[model samples]
Target: MTAPTLTETLPARETARSWWGDAWLVMTRELTPTLRDPFSVVFGLVQPLVFLGLFGPLLAGSVGATVPGGDVWAWFVPGILVMTTLFGTSTTGANLLFEMQTGAHERLLVTPLARSAQLVGRAGKEMAPVVAQSLLVVLVMLPFGFAPHPLGVLAGLVLLAVFGVGVGSLSYALAIAVRQQDWMFWAVQQTLLFPLLILSGMLLPLETGPRWMQVAADANPLRYVVDAERALFAGDLASATVAWGAVAAALTAALGLVVGVRTLSRSTR
Candidate 1:
């Protein structure tokens, strides 16, 4: 028995599905592998968990005073969630790269699905893993004396999903841009990822840093999101921090989606 081709799996033109329905189909196809191999999700989690275990304790001991409520878990855990979003969503393009190599991307391009749906569907899948990792991190920290407000944490997850969608879309755009030379994808990703992480203060507070560093952080959108996550996780939902974070997340999502869709459309043309 032979495997079904991309067109065989996609909805037929006679089906008359909306753009969202088409996107759903692409998302389900993209997610099928991750669903079948649960270990991949766990494996993807190792780095964030390790950072939580190792760097978290050191952060608490060293600069616990700088953290809100002087509770490091409250501050650190949300940052880890953002970190999970960053690392997890940023590398999603690698899978697209593999698809390109295998001619799977080309096959999908020739299908009747909307081009934007391909990018939207692919980026949408990023939310699930980040949600799982965020919940797991919260659960793991609870035993260690970490507690978050229920409603606030739920809101934080919504923000995280919005942010993840944007970052994931940008990553896919990068993948399409560098499809001709595979190594370039990794090169650009690594070069930009750490700077953004450090500037965003995911592992540590940046308040005591030099004025220049603080100014740089102020410009980084990720910083606002992290601040919002901290406030939300700490159950302070009605803060200026949360408002700024929501704005940043919304902007990033908008930009990432536009770039991703345009790139995919141009590449296929």
Candidate 2:
């Protein structure tokens, strides 16, 4: 029998770095479609600006700087950042659903890439836009006097990214499980958006709500992200609650990644 070719004979080292490299390639390729699409690229930047410009002033009085150590805009800034990340991350599932429906995903599966790599790549691509949105929120907040400690701001940004990754991975799984794109959109909006928005300290401070809401907020991962952002922007170092929140958010993302990889594996089969 002929010996295997050199390319085929070499051991496939599926290390973390290799997986990350594959994911980076996938992310780069995936980003082209998003960048080329004018609406998506524009909306990603514009939506948050509109929200901040319109709602920031309108709600400023109602959520005035009297409630706690932080000002109204400081609290609002973090929530807006979360909202921006959500919009960017949640829509990623639709792109995956489109690819799955069009057989693009199948084409990718024929390669030597591991299923986890594919999932991570797709997820990493989705996170790119969220990162952009988070940055934009920080820029917008700077003018409004929302300034967190340097380290705190960095931690908050990291947490936001982690939260988005977890949420996006979960949404991607749901998108694949469903048959149609519209249903995926609806489900994400209804199930993921409202709960995270309401329960998290996004629209309002968790302390301002009822006892049950406070408990629910404590359990919500997004709450930690919002808190981290709020604490950072408000320069409330002593009150910073993001260390535990970051740990929780990272754990959640890791779990979501595992679940997403399993789901993708099964679906491809």
Candidate 3:
């Protein structure tokens, strides 16, 4: 047979490419703006740093006693990392909203890129900023007694990335759903954010809360994430908490991607 034409070969080549490769390509494209304005990444760390400094000391006695090894920093730092992950990823949809408003999303749709790759890439892009901020939080707290288990911290980052992907994907889906009504996006985001944060016990332990509050925390997936982070940072990799956290993160990532990919497909079509 004659050699396939370039146009004929291109579709095959793209189809042969792995999903992750497509996702990586999309992630790199999404990261270009962040690279140009590196300051934004640094700015994102400010809130977590403030929480680390201000709230950490306050948890010394009460919360400290509850933590493993009696080190409050060990407990607080991981929660801060989770907090950073949650906040950073949860708002990523606004970027998509901006793109939608400018017709950039439309331009992207006309490209050969798979729509799922677009969602995965945008969601995966949040990992870099969250990881940078996490490392900074670790270093900043290191001298102050936040001793991390090297392997555990690495695993924790993996878990955090998974969770971030889920949160970011959901945000993008939400943006697509409310594309015509911008105020609804903000309203729903804010409405859900604080409840999740508080219920997750990132800033404080939920054990001391009343029965109803404790019951609510049990249902919050974030609570498991925070617990896993704390356990992982303390070098408890094999603990049931970490396993449950992994399950929770995996489920969230799966759900978000399913919902996001579906929403994106429906919208574009």
Candidate 4:
């Protein structure tokens, strides 16, 4: 005739144990608000599509000349796809800052959730919009003759998801570091993201950039990503391009997650 105490029924430290489960919990928490507002998701797609639509065709002829036998849409779609992930993941830190300021993060800290899982879950969930944008980009571009091979498209999505995790984690780390300073968060994100995009050879051919720019691009990890994406988009999978790109993306994700976890844990402490 014994009754279980509240503590026995609900162990605070045992609330979340599995890393993947904790991550999934965090992801769902982040996803609900965004899902409720469908417009926000759709709204984010407009600018990228606009670029794909207006920018793709307009620069196709000029950029196509750079490739040996360029199909205008072929040359441009991959870069646009990369840009979609970039734009989508660049704001990862902002919303976290909102949660921090609202003391939502403090509530999370009291839970048994792993600190890294917080970032992993949030960043991992961002794949939704990124993949959606990828699909939309392909669907929209398909009509205009952007004929990406099936496997290539699948590989490209993987590339984007990997890259998005990296970028999103970086944003979270930066955001946590600057949680009290909203202005600095925005400034740093905008400052770093656009420059990285430009240097990645997304909008133009890397070979054609100025000497210094080409040198800079050579060192940029994103260059590998774009190159891989471009090759995949063109259905050329039998090359080192995808391998190199995967390595770069994996490196970026690893570094970002490590940094993000450490930063968030320290901030909580």
Best by lDDT: 1
lDDT of each residue in 88-114, candidate 2, tens digit only: 776677777777778887888888777
Assess candidate 1 and give its TM-score to the true structure: 0.93
**Which residue pairs in candidate 2 have backbone atoms (N, alpha carbon, C) closer than 3 angstroms, thus clashing?**
148-232, 148-233
Stretches of model 2 off by over 4 angstroms after superposition: 1-17, 35-39, 180-185, 236-240
CA displacement after TM-score superposition, residue 91 of candidate 2 (Å): 2.3
The C-alpha local distance difference test score for the whole of candidate 2 amounts to 0.73
Q: Model 4, range 1-269, lDDT digits (tens) per residue? A: 89988767987766536999899999998889888987777788788878876777677656667753467677678888888788778787888888788888889988888887888998888888888778877887777767888999998999899989988999889988887777899898888888889999888777777899998888889889998998887788878988899999999989888998889888752
Error of 2 at 236 (Å): 4.5
Residue 252 deviation, candidate 2, in Å? Answer: 2.2
Cα RMSD for predicted model 4: 2.4
Tens digits of lDDT, candidate 1, 1-269: 99998778878974557999889988998889989997888887788889888998888789988886788888898999898999999999899999999999999999989999989999899888878878887887899988999998999999999999999999999999999998999999999999899999888778878999999999999999999999998889999999999999999999999999999999962
**Per-prediction TM-score:** 0.93, 0.84, 0.92, 0.92
- As for candidate 3, its clashing pairs are none
Q: Could you say which candidate leads in TM-score?
A: 1
Question: In angstroms, how far off is 102's CA in candidate 4?
Answer: 1.9
**Model 1, total clashes:** 0
**TM-score of candidate 4 relative to the true fold:** 0.92
